[model samples]
Target: MEVKVASPSASRRSSQTKKLVGGKRGCHVVVKVFPCKICFRPFTNGTSAHLHARTHLNSAELEKTSLFHAKCPHCQKMFFVHHHLTDHLFVHLSREERAEVAQGWRHGCYFCTKRFRVSSHLNLHLLTHTKEKLGGICHVCRKTFTSKQNLTRHGFAHLSEDEKIALVKQGRSRKCLFCQKKFPDNRAYHVHLVSHTKEKPFRCDHCGALFGLKYNLNKHKLIHSEDPRPFKCDKCDQAFSQKHHMTSHKRTVHRKLKDFACPVCGKKFGRKSHMVGHLRSVHAKIRHPSPHCGKTFTQKGHLGIHLRKLHPSEPSAK
Candidate 1:
């Protein structure tokens, strides 16, 4: 259950370096990191490496004390660490619901009667009732959003009345004649065109949402759904159902500053995914599914089951 952090050069280290540093440590493996002295292949992070190195300086008394800790709710067995408790809980969940509940304990948490689309939703929702509190606000509208992302979306409404009218008149949707592909935005359509021309011009500022066209970047903007979207608060940790609602709440109540920008067109994007999608459609030549797959995905939920039955491991229709 102990998750290890992988080092940047773990694969390239040599055994000779391990022997030089580890010496007579009881651990069977002798591993070393190329550049980082505190990191090695055998241990995931600097903390583990330092802890292991401690064994060389002392014996049993100096070693981290092995002790009994948390108890399992069902089996009544004691675990040595919190992770072991977590692993045992997973096993319990996988089997307990099948036996304990007479009918079925719906997908919602036992404590809250609220239903969720997925267990992940329930888990995140549980955080609200728990001790976790992360929130945000919008500066222009003086509104409060549950998360930072909602505030960003609210800023979109602050765009000039002229710009909103212009975008609406332009028709946000379009199609690529070359690929015969349809997209929700014109920028996406153009990005698809660049793929045939082989261009990879723009790079994502945060990570790798790179693209060859500005519009493609715009289309990518709709992809990321923040935790506190419509009513939530955190920028990265909260979840939400709608972007506009979140933004409105932030600006009207909390006074959050807007800082989103488009990487391809140099225009500002209200949200990050909007920009990424624009870049992807215009410049990135993504291979669409075969016509057969497209035909099977006429409905949203049906597409999930179709892809699951056909390509169980690939992206599902959902």
Candidate 2:
């Protein structure tokens, strides 16, 4: 009876040992083994578990990045690291965007009817048309991102004026050295870089609008609005809402017909746009917005603001 009991006990002990060894068939020998809660995959140790969590984190990050980022202002892709975004914005700040603004027609999506300085800007414009929700809902505005990095950056936009002031006072000027541009946070800057490259990985099969930038493209869809321009001009028989519309009208219609000759030189132009081009070429000293003004603006909006504040009496129409 004693021999029989010992034999059964030894067999049971061997069975328990086999079970433990079988569980570790594919596991590394040096590290502790455990099951990952998120992925359900067996991990070598705690470090591996932590690293594995990043896979789960990616979904959140992608949403945040997509929502906050505009587009690759350069290549116009949705993917980028922190430093790459900086390198891209340098292109926009270059002469290209400025020249397009001068030409009156900016780069915009024909499908969405949205315009931007760069193709990347149009990429972000496309994200708004997405229907899917990403990441978690932002506490401040209920907005979402593909990731937390995007969400956190967006949160700063909701900061109060005093909070922003405090942040600036702390000597925390979050600027990217590559582009010499500044942002409230790294995430916002990272998100902004998405506007530089043209890589829309996510595409919609329905509308056929290819977007690399965002998980959500619902904002790109158009909706009818009550905001309509009713103002029309009698001199050239044109319509406008803002005063600039009238100026664009005059430039396109009446001014284009006028053969004005410069008194300083023998140059004739039908319109001011053509004359501005002529002046820029021959009399480089006589710049369009004034070379001696000690300031150069990227867009007409900035010049309009300057005129409104500095020279209130001057007409600042288009």
Q: Tens digit of lDDT per residue, candidate 2, span 1-318? A: 011112112123211111122243443223235433322334546676546634333344545644333334344333235545554454344245545553554676656654665676565556566633455667743545755556766667656667766664554434432354556754455455445423343444346565535434433322122434455677855566555567557755765644444434757665545665566556665323623354655444566667666767645432
Tens-digit lDDT track of model 1 for 85-147: 664464434223534542343566667656654575676677566634344666643456555
Candidate 1 lDDT: 0.46
State the RMSD for candidate 2. Answer: 24.3
TM-score, prediction 1: 0.23
Question: Lowest-scoring 10 consecutive residues by lDDT in candidate 1?
Answer: 32-41
For each candidate in turn, the TM-score is 0.23, 0.23
State the C-alpha lDDT per candidate: 0.46, 0.48
Candidate 2 TM-score, true structure as reference: 0.23
lDDT of 1 at 17: 35
